[model samples]
Target: MSETKDTFFDFKLFKRLFKFIKPYKLVFFSLIICVVLLAGLSAAIPKLTEFAIDDSMTNKNPKDFVFYVTLMFAALILQTIFQLLFMYYASWLGQNLVKDVRINLFDHLLSFKMKYYDNSSVGVLITRAVTDMERIADIFGQGLFMIFRDLLTMTVVFGVMLYTNVKLSLIVLIMLPVLLYATRIFQKYMKKAFEEVRTEVSNLNSFVQERITGMKILQLFTRETIEHKNFKTINERHKKGWLKTVWYNSFFFPIAELSASITVGLVAWYGGLNVVLSDTVSQGVLVSFIMFIPMLFSPLRQIADKFNTLQMGMVAATRVFKVLDTTSHIDDSGNQIATSLKGDINFNKVHFSYVEDEEVLKGISFNVNAGETIAIVGATGAGKSTIINLLNRFYEIKGGDILVDGTNINQYTLASLRNQIAVVLQDVFLFADTILNNITLNHPEISEETVVEAAKAIGVHEFISSLPNGYHYNVKERGVMLSSGQRQLISFLRAYVTNPSILVLDEATSSVDSYSEQLIQNATDKITKGRTSIVIAHRLATVKKADKIIVMDAGEIVEQGTHDELLKKENGYYKNLYEVQFLQEKVA
Candidate 1:
């Protein structure tokens, strides 16, 4: 994140960014042409001034003055038109480039493995996708085109100054090295300052985002004052970062102005002597060079500013490209599509870990027949949910062979494989949208009538009817407006409408009210009727009617059988678990 660590000119990175703008090359290059023309016309203005001062004014000829005035006005008008085109097109190109890059960044994010998210911060990712992208777009708006236009103006001005008076141009050139050295020193300091600013921005955002997300927890613990103090500390650090940048700008601009003023004064002193000593030289030539001196140094001043713009953009681009360059996506090279799967799944000697050398599921094996309901009972972190994640291939197992209908899971295309499985998680997530859209998820293939039919079939239609708008009620972010049971019921309908061959109810009733729990129990019966269903439940009472119940401890399965069969085995894992786990649920 340190700016001094990065090169000012990253051609390779710009080359990568170029692809996004390549689609608009006609517009982009046309803008470049306009900038060049503008620069040329800007150079012509001083020459016309010299002509008006020395020739027409000295001769006192009104016709010559009038003709020169008309030509200068035409050039100024043409320059303005080119300037307009450059402004319009440059902004257009920048906005479009960032739009495409942001989409591409998000799409790449979607393909990453679950483990990537486990170790990364949501706030940092949000900054990269949003704030960092804005810095990049500014490259086109305030950086690239402006930088080029300034440089071209300086270059054209330089050549004209040399042609008009070689000695004055050389005198102005004396300040060039000193100005460049000062800029180098200033840039080095500001680069690190900008880096600190960006890092603090991410930190402040992460702290605020987490606190807001868990505001209820802070309130329950009565720690609002403590959290606010902590937030202020981070916010103060953010202020310090910005102040450092401001401090550098404070010292940098005045010195730059001093140097430009000194350089211009030297031009007047040296050029005036030449005007006195030589009969051939004109005061108008001195006047023209005096004007051209500022033009030459103006781009130099902007190079310092615009280079900062490009500097920030390259920094942002580096972070964005780092995300794009990740090789952490799940291997989705399998071409075999899973169409009409028989719902027979097998996990043979599966071993996996979220972190290296710390396995969560160790050499585990299981089989679910075509239409049997298997309930997995386990303590927290006993890897029951990990099984569901593995089955869906959210994380690649280190050593295992998972088969669906006798074919290895890796042999099936990821999208097709995931399409056949439906999961209603312990914590249901609903979008900030209508109840019906949350259920359908914009799946136009699943008609509105079909979703309504599925909801009623699951026995939760009465609940929906009681709501103000029935199915059309807006869930308003994570379904916070609805009761836990109501959200679970919506999840049920979502799963049913999809008609996935394999159904997973992971603690579907663990945190719901008794009324909604009963409805979910009834819906569970209907949803698991013919599919290969797996229920990971904390309450053993909820799994009594399951075709088979598997008990797990740590990372290994210790016992599994029918409920009645497991009840007879004294001191067995399932028998002991039934007493210990269910008693707690009853007490709560």
Candidate 2:
């Protein structure tokens, strides 16, 4: 987010990206060869014109003029052919590179702990993977090729001009310093403008994504007008940023053009004077000098423009690398795999904090035997969710070891540890896919029969069967097409499909109707019958069936007992919570 002009061309990031192109080395080399050939043919065209003027025009030889004209046309044709090949290869390479980078980035993102998603915006992350990667691809495909072509053409033209007419070449060379200085200034403004553009774009993307996703909340609050006005303000800022970039580019092109023209003009004046005064240089040579001067500056202008593009691309690349540079707070440290988990979970005097020096869970310890169903109840922010998060290894405990099956959880690969756990959250999220796919996310290799069995076990198969497409019904984004209870049912089915040793249901039925809640309770009871289950619920009824109830308040466990024992407590948190929910149910 900072606009500081740090070095955007990160060599490490380039090295990683370059590895993706290694498989297409031959195509890459061929493209470079084509670019060189195109540059050579382009540089030779002006020389051909010079030959036509000096040899054919001066001598009035129609045959020679026609032959040279034909040769020039042939050169143009070859140039076009090679240019096409170069472009095709460049485009292919760029697109493949983008694809590879995106795939790798996506995989890397998945490997990160859930905490990364908690701290970052989905919209900005999506933009980095799609838009920013495309911008970098454009640089690799077009910008780098242009830089090479222009450099080659400029070098060849200048060398040829110097050899043919040293004095005039020297006069034209004077413009180089001025061009370089102007470009230096242009790059400064251009880099700043480009950084601003990327910032504005990221902000706009975030705003749009938030607005769309929170449309329901906006309607509930009747704040659509306020949201629209905010969006308009963001739009105006983006427009202003874009216009500033455009104006800077507008000034840049003309400065480059005027400098090129001035260089050509100086050459024409000095060359004509030398010829008129001493007759030392022939008319043909003077004419060639005039033509070559413009040819040389044309590539110069291209180089300037390419440099501007490169700067912009570097800005995008920096943003992308920032994401890649973030270190995952939770990472797998062990290569060991637990062949089997007995689900004996132990929290040994654990301490944790989202921020330094502020512990959320302090010196807490608990243990649960295999196949035991434990319920965690607490006031809001009483660290109930945080405890479950630790059990899932979503956040590493700052101080103490969490052991599974009498072995430290960190002693096993994260995948190995997580593979044994299944979670069903209150706010269930389903991908845009068939109902069957959502339930079968964990076990895509499972047969359709198995999918139906799992759905039926969760009491969702009947509802799905009633739909026109049954299990094949498409779940729109975030399962928007399904009701909340239906989403919860599908989520439970998904967890069941995984067949995990440890089950976590975090308020899994809190948002559902009574009927759906009963369905979920039945399904959860069946699924957790022989698994180590941790259920966090706001609705006390859901946890009454739990084997052991642990009450938490302000990050510490206040009480632990069976349902009957907790009910007998005079003023315990669980008893109070149960009374409140019971009164609410009676009122309903």
Candidate 3:
């Protein structure tokens, strides 16, 4: 994400957001027009009061008084209609703009490379997508329109005050410079306060999200008190951030009121003096200034308050717009279409590093022919999983050429390439949905009957049938309703039903009961049948019948052979790994 610094406002960010509002230009302009007309009508109200007092009440002219009153009533009616239209159209424009912005951000997120997710916080992204978007929506829905209303009120009110009686107006204007200075100071400090508040809010959200998602682990380890203490610390910081903003608000509003009261006092003192001297100033003009002075000052006070909203909204816009402008996504420039892949895979001298200058995979190379099953065994942090990640183009290799059917993988569109390669990760992720939905993943073409048939072929149909709702059972969040082995079985069935040209399985190392093991082994056999398959081997017995076993150590391949042939070597890497990591599985 691009960094956001505290400024009174961010014009550049608004320029970017204005693009989303382009589609609703007519509605936005109409809202502006209504505000301008409302301001003019509103200014006319005080002038009507001066005319009614001077020409009707003082002179006792019933006809002139009735004329002014009737006109004021007409203005009020027009004002009400414009206000309604302004509100309705403003909301419509804001919601429509926010909808477009939300879709744009989500689409951009979908294109981001896996590397971005690896280093970013999910909670921060959630905050940006949801909370920040709402704040931005308020800019148009409430803040901006209110600001325009208040500003126009002040401008129109000031112009009439000067025109009606210049002497009283100048007396009232004496407080303007001081108030203006105060407003500038308020905007500066409040902008800083809100910037800090948003940061704290994001941090608090990230902490809470992680804690709730990992509540199971916290309970299992009995770390509730420890975690709660940590949460309190974060919560306190969040509260403090908001309190600072409130502090500035508390100080600023009272100062605004004090300034306005002083202006009123000056107007009364000077206007009363002129009347005592029998000067040209009329009583109606003095009273009009009294009424109009507050109108001007009230908007000034309100403008100060609404400017807070405007500033906060802009801060949120800064964050949301940054995401929309992000360029750290997969480059889908390749137009090559993949109708069918031959299942022939090759990695030639691939080099990669998750962090700069710290290689994870060092000059690794491998190949698998069509219809071959290759089992890869390795020690932890040995680049075994990285190879599979590269094959799917999840991460671009630092230096290497990965080809399928002799064409570079980069030459194919990511969608077309990934559609043909299905992977069943060790940590399976299932939506809080029914078993059937989890398997089919809402694919229109993949029917329930087809999913059930695939489950039966993989030998997991009996276990699924025994569940309370069978295929309709809701797994709950992250498949919490299912056991680890049961979830693994579901993952296997999910991959099997995909029927892709190539399959990649990150074998789970967790222990399972004998029954689940038998089901898994059978499912694995069916999925790997007649395809180029790569298995990150976790059990020696599971891969003993494989066509080849490749052993990796510290990003280098040190052993390559079938199970028996590798065991015959005295100090073969595969033999040592089998004894240490998978010996118990073989004994079982």
Tell me, by lDDT, which candidate is best.
1
| Per-residue lDDT of model 3, residues 136-160, tens digit only | 8888887788888988988998898
Candidate 2 lDDT by residue in tens digits, 1-588 = 334555434465567667888988998888888877887887788778878877899899989999889999999999989988888788789888878878878888887778788788888888898888888787777677777888887788788888888888888878877877876777677778777888888889988998899999999999999998999999999999889878877887787788778887887788778778987676777777777766677777777677667766667777877777777857688788966687898989999988779888888888899999999888888888898788778888899889999988888888888878989998999999998888887465777899888877777788889987998899889999989988998898888887889999998988998888988888887998988999997665667778898888888888898889998999888789777775577466
TM match of model 1 to true structure: 0.96
Question: How do all models score by TM-score?
Answer: 0.96, 0.93, 0.95
Worst 10 residues of 1 by lDDT: 1-10
Weakest lDDT window of 10 consecutive positions for candidate 3? 1-10
Off by over 4 Å in 1: 1-6, 273-280, 583-588
For model 3, state the Cα shift of residue 537 in Å.
1.0
Ranking by TM-score: 1, 3, 2
Native-to-model Cα distance after best TM-score fit, residue 119 in candidate 1, in Å: 0.5
Instruction: Name the top TM-score candidate.
Output: 1
Please list all clashing residue pairs in model 2, or write none if there are none: none
